[model samples]
Target: MWKLERCPPHTGHQYLYHGSEEEELHVSRQVGAWLRLQGDASISRKHASLKVSHSAQAVKRSICGSIELKELGAKNGTFVKHSNSQNSAESEAREAPVFTEEHRLSSGTEVVLRHGDVVRFGLYDYCYRLVRCELLVATSMLPRSDTVMRDLLLLGGSYSKEWTQNCTLLVMETIKLSAKVACALACGRSVVRPDYLTQLCTAVKQKQQQLPATRDYLPTITEASIQPDPSLFDPNHDRKSVLSGKLFLLSSPKLLKRVQCIVEFAGGKCEVVAARHHSMIEAGDAVILRTPDDANLPSQSPMAAACKVVKRAGLHVVRESDVVLAVLYCSTERFCNPALSQQVLVSTISQSQMQQQNTGIIYAPETQAISNSPASVLSSRSNKTTRTTSAIIPETPGSTGPSSTLIKSPFTPAATATIARA
Candidate 1:
């Protein structure tokens, strides 16, 4: 009886991540990686040979969504076959599967493994193996293989006009390049398709080009004053503070409500109004933002307006702040794509706050006053508890605990916010 070596061609009936033997297979031949099946099965193929291995506990992930697979050095090199035969060489090399969501390994047949190749199992443990064969080259370069492939894909013309206009491809490709290959490939064929890769490349390129050109001027938020509409504000002719200036809140409607509640509870009254058109804000104002759960929203929604506000007002309101207690309620599961979640996490990372320091437009937890207001007490709690209300005219509800309220001191520097609505 020939014992399974458990080495090189380590044929196993089970997977570390999926925990099964009969798994689905999708290979990106270009990058020499495979995508894990969605069901409970593990798959292994040998390059240049006719044997394939299977198990029952394999995991599954998506192309552009959650779950990913990466390859480790294995005796059998994973291959991704394409639909078109005319450009087989070009397609084979370019479509060489790494852990990318652009292309899946459907339709194409799995090839036998040889030396210097790799195979990835599933998402949980993200297990992978490298078949020790003479063909194995330096494994160090594989870590950055995605980057080189992206550059190559961009230069090779594998995207479309819609992808460029919409900026989907580039973003997706950027993520693929950033992710570990072993984890990417385990996601399986659903995430290893051709159209997906092309789209990702296009979107990423567009975003890279749209970066702000100058730090001095940002786009206007809401310059057109609604002061004429008495319904918009109170008619306090002499009373200076009345939601008079504008602020841009670049947050989701849900989060906006929560923050507003916190402010009101803390005795600070501010209006959650629509952003203005091309309006610039004064320093010492607040800009609140809720990181977009969907990657497409930031590019499609009021994000452009917020960017304009930031450029002109010299302010950027981040999500995590200590001066103005920002509460975070995001979970990794809410996002469809892990890459998109990562981007949100990066944008929302917590930052330290300085006491009584005011930073303009982008609300740094400083207590600087952007506008001048006469002294007036804002009563939040009816009892002995003290509530700090903002001088801004619009009033909101009151607070319950230390974690809910953000108090702005009177001595802080003055700033104004400018908002715009699309």
Candidate 2:
């Protein structure tokens, strides 16, 4: 089966319609049998017809079919914006152009619709997303005449006019209702119980309040906080001691306790500071551990003010993702190198952006030289340090004497090492 769900910017009562295989569903301003779309003057009396067709080898418990949208001869035309998943590399590389742009369907013309496709009727602010519905039983076996959609909407508290007035609440409630209804239908229950829906919605609302808000700010490395610890340089010490000599100034309130625990457990120091206490940040090597909510901070916000102070001081501003990566790989050497730090920041930002967009694109980071193994990362860091330093000494393969070489360490100004050959 297929379902058409009303998208955001709700102008009228929320709309949700279901169509079975080989069924022709009509969309118009009329309220009789047709999917009613009100408050849109651009919608004609007979706007469009959705022709549903099932696949030859349709699975019993899955949505497997296609929908052909036929445009009626109306004053305005039908337009569609294909989903991001369809706009792949192969689609772009083809000689024939994919419908990357909003494509209009000529009168009497038909086009096959894909899942997540947003269809608009005329030029007004009315749009609906086409979605697939997977049911446990066959479409033919289910009751043809029933109030399942209406009951589901009412049970989820989204069928009221007041609910549709608030666009954000409408969308959120609709998503919740859709999930509950889909689960019930998948389990062979056409109707969702009101008690069960109420319980589920309450739990979901509580969880949403607890989760962190999403933000768009990407962490950039303009300055490197290279407080090198001799313990970190030594391979014999445990990797948890990598943060031995560093102090972190955390500004994000939501992630303050969580990040503080992580930093303290790794043998590092932490200080909590607000916007008024800019002086406290001076003592810390790295200021401001950026979180997802940082993007939403206004200029007048305390967190934003603290970030500006960190920027002006030219201190390293670490991201939550970067901290996780450093802890996972058990190496802070990348943060010491400005170039490597920038690379890591860019890769993390790309990954976050892709996830936000839900594009399902795989991002391969460019740091091929950096491996996951702590031993390999340590070897690479040593080789890189040796190459950049002015001091150079070649070991005689047959010699048995200890050779002295002078090299500069990131933590200290300079360090001397003796290499013994057998």
Candidate 3:
């Protein structure tokens, strides 16, 4: 059952009178039970229907929609959003969903609701959100008919576009990256393939040219293990930087995929180091993330029993959800790429550190006062190395990504969001 309240077409908070997983909650003026929008005259007696789902891993599509779209493949299930005229309040609106083709929503169609979703109803366009979600453990006490369905409550999801936009943004991320990769590979087989390959090779050379020479050097990791912002990423300070860096998610694959999406959207890269912390120190260098809780973890998840490896690595660990919002929030940075940073100096791992790490020991970089002038420093190899101050290496540069830092913050969103839609 899904309860919705403080919304239009209803007088107060109302419950869906829980239904079986085999059944859906139907909202209609004509239907007295379930949810009834009897107060709104502009809405059809049976204006729209909603279906709720719980398992994220389950195939989210409904057989009620077109099979063609299902065949096309959507990693997550397809959802709908009703398009309203600029003047959404006009009661005379006649545009309705185009049902000629299932799963295909033309401009003004009402969307079927999904997990963590809320939608609008009636000419006044009152919105709702899946605000309170709880898994009932004592379902045995309830009637068997309704017990199979996952219970949900959506209330006043939002009057503003924030919620919907965030959902849309996250959803669009997979679309964006997959499309780019598809195009890249497809083009690689064309006559332009040689040129494309050459361009990539040339770009790599250009990157190496920009990088300060790699010398065996120890970094001063004054930055806290999980600290997000340093003197460099202050958005108010207003400086250009390379936004692309690496993300290390020492957590579950589910979290890895989500964080990877956000990182790709931000033009960065990410790698998942499945909690075998010592094997991959660089994974924690740039940004480290973990699954917020064990709720969605799979059986035998490698991230299930991870310890303080993130903290000891001189990197801060953030929640999985925070990573997306934080990265999106960090788009405020002027310099968006690490390779394009003022100067990137990669700190290669020494054999000694690797050996020590295997024994479950972690070390923070020793703080050193950077010299004002270019100076020669002794490499671990005992060779003379010359470099400037203020360069930090990006963590996990070798990981696979669409290529994206993001400033760390408690992450209060701006007064307004960057995404707005009609």
lDDT per prediction?
0.26, 0.41, 0.29
TM-score of each: 0.19, 0.29, 0.23
Q: How many residue pairs clash in each candidate?
A: 113, 0, 21
Worst 10 residues of 2 by lDDT: 413-422
**What tens digits encode model 3's per-residue C-alpha lDDT throughout 117-143?**
334455444444332321111110011
Better of 1 and 3 by TM-score: 3
**Quick one: ranking by TM-score, best first?**
2, 3, 1
Give me the candidate number with maximum lDDT.
Answer: 2
What does candidate 2's lDDT look like per residue over 34-100, in tens digits?
5666888888898998765653233321324467888997578889888644422223345433336
lDDT of 2 at 127: 79
Model 1 lDDT tens row, 1-422: 00111223334322111112343233322234333223323333321212223211110110111112333332332332122222222234555433322132332334433222333332222233322211001111111334424432232222221111111122121111111111111111011223333343444333232222211121121212111221211111221121223243534554454334333322233333246533433344544443322124555456555555555564444331211321111111221111223334333321111222232222111212322332233332222323222322111123121222222321212111111110
Ranking by lDDT: 2, 3, 1
